[model samples]
Target: MLGELEMVKAVLSGSRRTVVLTGAGISVESGVPTFRGRDGSWKNYRPEDLARPDAFEARPELVWEFYNWRRESLRESEPNAAHLALAEMERKKNNFLLITQNVDGLHCRAGSRKIMEMHGSLWQIKCTKCTHAREDFSPLPPMPECPVCGHLLRPGVVWFGEPLIPGVLRVAIDEINKSDVFLAVETSSLAQPAASFYQLAKDHGAVTVEINREPTPISGFMDFALHGKASDILPELMAGLSE
Candidate 1:
């Protein structure tokens, strides 16, 4: 039997089109807390409480407070080895796509050109009363207003109960369908849509791989399950592709 690393290398060696799906675990090494973890709370409120459209509608100031804190916290966080390795993978592959659930913009900072931020981004803001939206990394006030409409501005993230940014799902599914190899990295495999991507790739005849710190619900489904820190495993995997 081939070793796990050898098996992964063999799969990548034959792959032409690859799609990668990532979640919060990939960013945890960069000091970002997982949404369901103990550190996800602030001022006696959970992330679920603050990251909702209703919460922003009722107390915009409080919502902004939480997001602003998150933004400031992430401002200094740099992409780890895993992120850089993925960027290198993108550069090497002719057809590569990175779909991430994280909103921190670390993938972009790491130089991954083909990316889909399924959950939206912390650096983007939109007007509540108009169609104006733009990226702004500057520190925001308690109640930032739209430059175009003066209406209250909100973080560009897909708040709970809100639909994903239009067309992101369609494009992601299209890529998954065309993938020759699918890698789920640092994901818990609990969230919807993304949780099912591995199965979709399998159905489409793609090799499925999972790289995570712990076993998840879908670990048994992957063709190869590599359990470890993504910052360590990803660089090693990418290095094997060159040999």
Candidate 2:
């Protein structure tokens, strides 16, 4: 087992590019319920039935209801110390990129620049017909058509059956391949393409680090396994790096 302190020290002092992959665990610190625990919706309801594009198309109202509830939940939460630590890392170094699976905008709010949101964002909405993008914070009535083109409005997220945004995926892949250090933070290590990102980073000769409370699928493959909550561990690890 690599010493957590020594691993972080090496990350701070390393010369190659650094890439960060964040997941639901980081948002858990901000009071957002993860999708895998006792209260996780995935255990009770099938995400494919709810998160698929077909579901949204057949019942936009239902889809919006879930998303709106999520939006409200996120509104009450604040960015935690772990998010701030990443921002601190950005300030201290020039070769870092933060890639997140969360729809919450906490990372951006915490001032982490160079972030690539793999799943898209809740703050953004778009017209299904005209590509009109809007960022609205309030609940909306059933949007029947695009304001500009009369097309049905939809959430700006990658649905269960949809492909990821090509531009964002391209950037993430490029960064992972270019990095000399890659950190997987608070992720389940089971999510599809996202889990694969860590392997890509490793294949590129980057040192891979996993920060989670428990062992995950890729635990054995990681160079360092830092066991703790990101909010508690990240701040402590980064405390001395800003100097």
Candidate 3:
């Protein structure tokens, strides 16, 4: 049997249509905490609870408080080598696409241009009343209002009960359908929609690859599985590709 590196290299060779999906596990190396793991609690509140639309409507200030803290925490952390390597792959591949479930925006920071953020972003905010939105990381105070309509400002993200952004899922699906190789990086493959992507790609006759700390729910279905930290594995894979 080929080792993980050789397998990934072999899979990637001659592949012009590739899609990489990332999750919180990839961002944890940059000091950002995983949402469902160790950094799961904040002031006695679960992130899932606070990240809901009902919760935000109940207390927008409280929601902002948590988001602001999270934003500030990640503001200083730089993208790791894995991030840079992925960005390099994007620069080199003509038909490469990156789909990330992380809200931290590290993929963008790492310079991956063709990206789909499935979970929305921490640095983005929109008005409660209108649709006006822009990238703003300023600390929001009590009753922070929208600039356009003077309404409350909320983090631009897919809340617990909300649907994804209008066109985002379609883009991801389209990419997966057309990709010859689909890499599921650092995600548990348990989350809905995103969890279904690799399987969707496989059904469409694409080679599905899994790179994570452990075997995920979809591991059994993947054509190639590599169990390791993305920080360590991704760079090595990229190196092999370049060689």
Among all candidates shown, the one with the greatest TM-score: 1
Quote the lDDT for 181 in model 1.
97
Model 1 lowest lDDT segment of ten: 1-10
* Ranking of candidates on lDDT, top first: 1, 3, 2
Using TM-score as the yardstick, the better of models 2 and 3 is 3
lDDT of 1 by residue, 67-97 (tens): 9999999988999999999999998888999
Error of 2 at 8 (Å): 2.5
In the range 1-243, model 2's lDDT, one tens digit per residue, is 336667676676664578889999998879988877877784256555788888887888788777777778888999999999999988887888999998888999999978988888988889887768988787666553578987678878888878999788888888899898888999998887898988898888888888898889898999888888888777777866643
lDDT of 2 at 86: 90
Q: Which whole-number lDDT from 0 to 100 does residue 184 have in model 3? A: 91
Question: Which segments of model 1 are wrong by more than 4 Å?
Answer: none
TM-score of 2: 0.93
- Per-residue lDDT for 1-243 in model 3, tens only? 248678778778768699999988898889888878866899989998899989988887888888888888988888987788889888767899999998888889999889888878988888888989998767667567888999888888888889999999988899899999999999878789998998899899999889999888888889998888888888777775742
